[model samples]
Target: MEFKGAMGGIYRLTEWITRLAATNLLWVLCSSPFMFCLILKLLVMNQNLANESLQMNWAMAILAPLTLFPATSAMFTVVRKWVMGDTDTGVFRTFFKGYKENYKQSLIGGIFYTLLFVIMYVDYTVYMTQLSNLQIVGVIMLILIIILLVSMFNFFSMVAHYHMSIGQIMKNAVLLTLIRPFRVFSTMLGSAVVIFIGVKYPVLFLFFIGSVVAWFAFFNFYGTFLKMQDQMEKMKQKDEEQESVEDKKSDNLQK
Candidate 1:
C-alpha cells in the first residue's frame, strides 16, 4: 500500500538512497581485488616502502582492466537505467546483465585508457621536471590528460548507453567531449564534487560515491545524447527538403 503525504516523500527518498547504496556496494564487491591493491598501495606509501608501493601499483594496474573497468561499466549501466526513468528495475539483475554484455568492450577500452594515461603521465612528468625549458609542453600534456580523463567519463556513459563498437564509442566520446565544452565541464565539475565528498567521508565510498557519480555522469550524457539526436534529425529533414526542391526543379526542366 502507498503511503500518503510526507510519508510518501520519505518513502521515495529512502528508496532512492537504498538503490544508490546497494548499487555502489555491488560495484565495490565486483572490484574488490583492485580496491584491495589500491588500499595496500596507500598503506605501503604511508610506511614509505617505495618498492612495495611500486609493486602494488603494478598489481592494481593489472587488475584494473580485468575487474575495475567491467564493474564500473556495469555500475554505469544501472545508473543509466535510473537516469532514464527505470528506477524500479532490479539492481542485481540489471548490474549483471550489463556486466555480461559489456565486459569485453569495457576491458578493451580499459587497456587502451590505462596505457594512454601511463604514457601521457610519463611525458608530463619528464617535461615538467627533467626538461624545465619544456614546461610549456608539460602544461599542454596536463591539459590533454585532463581531457582524456573527462573523455573516459564520457566513455563509461557511452558504453552503458550506446550499442556501438568500442572504436565508435571512443570516437564519439572524444568528439562529444571536445565539441560540447559545457557538458564536458559540467561532468568534470560534478565528478570533482563527488570525489571531494567521497574523500572527506571515506565511508561514503562503501555506500554512495561510485553509483552517485555514475548516475550524474550518465544523466549529463543522456541529455547531450538527446540534443545530438534532435540536431541530426533536423539535418536529415533539411536534406530531404532540399532533395524535394531539386526534384521539383528537374520536373520543371523536363517540361
Candidate 2:
C-alpha cells in the first residue's frame, strides 16, 4: 500500500508537469506564424530609423497595426486561455480567439510601444548632436528608461487580455514584476540565451530551434505566474469571507 501510494503521488506530479509543459508548447506553436510578421516589422522599423528621408508612407504607417496588433492579440488569447486551464483549445483556436478579443488592446498597445520607440529615437538623435559632459549618463538613463517602460508595457498588455482596467492592470503588472523579480529576470535571461545561441550557430537552423525553446520557456513562466495570481485572489476572497463571518457572529452575540 505504501509503495502504491508513493507511485500514485509520483504519477500525479509527473502528470502536472507534463500538462504544464504541453500548455506552453501549444502556445509556442500557435504563435509561430507571427514570427515572420515580427521580423518584417523589425526590418521596416530599422529602415525607417536609419533613413530619415524615407517617406512616411502607408507601409510604414501600417506596420504596427498589421504585424504587431494581430500577433499580440493572438498571443493574448493563447496566454489567457492557458492561464484559465483550458487545455482543449488547440493552437489555431487560441490564435483566432486571441485575435478577436485582443484586437483593440493590441492596436492600442502597439501605438504606445511605437510612441516610446519614437521618443527613444528622438533622444538618440538629440544626443548625437551634442558633445556634452553628461552625454554618456544621458544615453545610459535613456536606455534604462526604455527597458523599464517596455517591460512594464508588456506586462500591462498581458494583464489587459483578462479585461482588466488600465489602472489595475498597470498596478498588477508593476507589483508582479517587483514581487517576482526572479521570474522576470529568468525570462529576460532565457530570451537572451536563446538569441545568443541562435546567432552563434547559423548553419543548423539554430534560430528556429532557439526561438521554439525561448517561446516554451516564456509560456511556462507566464502560465505559472497567472496560476499564482489566481491562487492569491482566491486566498484574498477566503480571508474576506472569514472576516465577514466573524463580524456577523459578533453582531448576533451583541443583539
Candidate 3:
C-alpha cells in the first residue's frame, strides 16, 4: 500500500510538471512569428532617429501590423481555449487555425491600426514642428489616439471569443471601451507594468515575456468578456419578460 501510494504521488507530480512545461512551450511557439517582425520594426523605426527619413520610417511600419496581427490573433486563440478549460485541443492546431481564420481580417485591422498610428505620429510631429496653431487640435487627437490604443488591447482577444465581421469587431471594441473603460485602463496599466519589469530584467523578456503578457492579457479580457456577456444576457431576459407581460395583457383584452 505504501509503494502504491508513493507511485500515485509521483505520477501526479509528473503530470503537473508536464502540463506546465507544455503550456509554456506552446506560448513560446506562438510568440515566434511575432518576434521576427518585431525586431524588423524596431530596427527600421530606430534607423536615423536623429535625422530620420520620413518615407523610410513609414514604409517599414507596414511590417508590424501585417506580422503582429496574425501572430497575436493566433496566440489569443490558444489563450482563449486554455482559459475556458478546453486545453485538450492541440496548441499548434489552435494557434494556426486562428492565424489562418483571422488572417485576412487581422491584416485589414493591422493596416488600419498601423495607419492610424502613423497618421497620429505624423500629426503630432507636424503640430510640434510646423502647425503650432493646431496644438489644441493635436491634444484632442492625442486623446483619440490613446483611446484607439487602449481599445486595441482587447481587439484580438475579442476576435477569438466572438464571430463579428472586422468592421463590426472594430465597432464592438469601441463599444467595449465605452462600456468597460475601467477594465480597458486596467489592462493597459497591467501590461505596461509587466513590460516595464521585463525591460528592467531583460532575461524575463528573453524566455517568457511574450507568453506572460499574453496570458495576463487574455485573463483580463476573459473577465471583461464575461461581464459584457452577463449584461447582455440580463438585457435579453428583461426584453423577453417585457414582451411576455405585454402578450398577457393583450390576451386578457381578447378574452
Clashing pairs in 1: none
User: For model 2, how does the per-residue alpha-carbon lDDT over 1-255 read when each residue is reduced to its tens digit?
Assistant: 999999999997775455444444444444444444445556667777644333333244446554545554464455455555665566556666666666666666556656666666667656656757657855875875546553653453454355765445545655666666666666666666766775688432211443243344446556656789899999999999999999999999999
lDDT of 1 by residue, 44-70 (tens): 999999999989978987899999999
Off by over 4 Å in 2: 1-62, 79-88, 128-131, 136-140, 143-146, 149-161, 165-175, 201-255
Which of 2 and 3 is the better model by lDDT? 3
Give the Å error, residue 58, model 2.
Answer: 10
Better of 1 and 3 by lDDT: 1
How many angstroms is residue 187 displaced in model 2 relative to the true structure, after the best TM-score fit? 0.7
TM-score of 3: 0.79
In order, what is each prediction's RMSD in angstroms? 1.8, 7.2, 4.1
Q: In model 3, what lDDT does residue 167 have?
A: 93
TM-score order, best first, reads 1, 3, 2
Which lDDT values do the candidates have, in the order given? 0.93, 0.56, 0.75
Q: List the residue pairs that clash in candidate 3.
A: none
